[model samples]
Target: MNSVVTRRNLLKLGLIAGTSLIAPRLFAQAHTNTQEIFITNLHTGETDRVLFYDQGYYLADGLDRLAWLLRDHRRNEVGGMDPKLYHLLFSLQQRYGQQKPIQIISGYRSQATNQWLQKNSDGVAKVSQHTFGQAVDFRIPKVDTQELFDVCCSYRQGGVGRYLSSRFVHIDTAGVRHWG
Candidate 1:
């Protein structure tokens, strides 16, 4: 039996082999580009590892869960957290070159909570960004607080507060300002 080896068949074979070889690499690249956040809320003992951004779109469900996770524990109120804040956190993770879960010391703060803290604490701001869901106090496990603070400061995107004693770094999506 003589089978004619046609150019079209050869081209099809080459294309199939090329696609087979390239598909996995493309998938891996997409996986790597996916922006994920792993967080543990210290106050509520809630944890989430979410792929919030894939390709170029932010997942609404992931954002919703993140907002719930970051809710004010005192009043159990969920605020509309700024998406930029999440992006900032994602950027921090990328900058650190690690996928460690960020331990959230604080996230959204209710007006009552903020007011009470301001009245009771010496360093708490009267008009805190946390009340507006624009700030987060967090620390990545095994990452130095100073190093994290430095990384945040380098971004110059917003506020970066270093509470060395507390072993946490405060980040915000407000105007550039910093405090200890």
Candidate 2:
């Protein structure tokens, strides 16, 4: 098979190579507060492994990329994502030390989308943290939902919702609480 190397493909290859080359150095500096996470939005099949924090600073471009990946798929809107939410995800990933991406069932929600969901759903909150980009419904691949919920609740940093039927745990940057 003939593989044509277009400019786009070349750029992609370069990015992959560059990331691989620097990954060792990046991970080496993980002790210096380098926070990274891999996320895959299940709704849109969008994914990225972003290094969002370094030495107590959140990288703007990385955060934007994450928000883009985590945007409202229904309405195609990108909201301002709270940094604390990213921290929560980072902590979860670090605790489990998983290589698989966090599969996001839901992320930011536009007001219209939230209201539509509220109207159609029985348990979706009328004032959801998702509207403010402060919550995420996600699950790790091959990881049990009960274990995920327990780990999240252990932090006691935010609201945790365990949806057993859906097999996703919702963590929000609201006051500490848990509900199934």
Which candidate tops lDDT? Answer: 2
lDDT of each: 0.87, 0.90
How does candidate 2 score on lDDT? 0.90
**Whole-structure CA lDDT of model 1:** 0.87
Could you tally the backbone clashes for each prediction?
0, 0
Q: For residues 90-164, could you state the per-residue lDDT of candidate 1 as single tens digits?
A: 887776655687889889999999998888876898888999999999998889999999889888989999999
Summarize candidate 2's per-residue lDDT along 80-135 as a digit string, tens digits: 88888888898888777659899999999999999999999878999999999999
Runs in model 2 deviating more than 4 A are 1-32
User: Candidate 1 clashing pairs?
Assistant: none
Q: On a 0 to 100 scale, what is the lDDT of residue 118 in model 1?
A: 85
